[model samples]
Target: MLTLRMFIQKSDVISFKNMEDLYSRLNISKNLKDEFKSLISELNDYLDRYSPLTINSHEMRFEKLSTSEPNPDQLTNRELMDIYLYGDYAHLDSSKRVRFERIAQNNLFAPMGNHVFVTIVNKLVEIIDRAVEMNKQAIEQLKDQI
Candidate 1:
């Protein structure tokens, strides 16, 4: 039996695009698909709420703001999610860690804080677990028929 821990330990950084590829390869069910979409939408909403000033500004202001470069370490929630999903958290630079800590301290973001990020990751891992379980069941059934 595949436990969540085992599954996560075996996983690599799966980009958003790559997740779609995995879904195709696994032939994931509609329920799982909808759940994945909902999780993604929630992540998007969080990102929109906490989006950096540059990306959140008005179009007219963009031209002027465009001249000034945004801090590469000033990541959106989505970017942070990507990092958590695929990147080595332990290896993250001090700057990125500080930036993430700042976001965790934000009044608006504090309510959900790190929990939301963890929840999304856990949900994705659950999907993978379910897929593996389903595959095992199918294999066993096939064996029974033979």
Candidate 2:
């Protein structure tokens, strides 16, 4: 639910994009859209160094993971993040069946991947919370003028 609300774009749902716009319209100092992009960029760097895969995948099954090193060739953290978000958490994408299945069957990294994903989501919520807090006093004053 939080995944969809934060990542997915639906007309009926209030997403991070929507919140970004709202923050802008409310004249909040921070640009939320840019902040989100920065967060993703930081996450990508971290992911490249330490992938979602566990250090001890050698102890478990390796059939699902084709390569000795986990994670697909040239597949960015951003791509995997989107795949996991849509395929497992929120709405299903028929077009992503192949990639999605790859992610689903990889049980060895599932726990670590899920933990990282949840942490990302938590960080997003924190950013939003801070944005709201930063603008609270100004917003309260604006309300009185109206």
Q: Give the winner by TM-score.
A: 2
Prediction-by-prediction clash tally: 1, 0
lDDT of every model, 2 decimals: 0.47, 0.51
Q: After superposing candidate 2, which stretches have Cα over 4 Å from the reference?
A: 2-13, 27-77
Q: What is candidate 1's CA lDDT for residue 56?
A: 20
Candidate 2 global TM-score:
0.54
Candidate 1, 41: how far from true, in Å?
14
Give the per-residue lDDT digits (tens) of candidate 2, residues 31-137.
54455445444544644443333223233222243436654343434455566666665677764444666545677655655665666566556655655664465
lDDT of 1 by residue, 40-138 (tens): 455346543322421222111112223355544344445655444333354555655655555455666544445656755665565665555545654
As a whole number from 0 to 100, the lDDT of residue 132 in candidate 2 is 60
TM per candidate comes to 0.38, 0.54
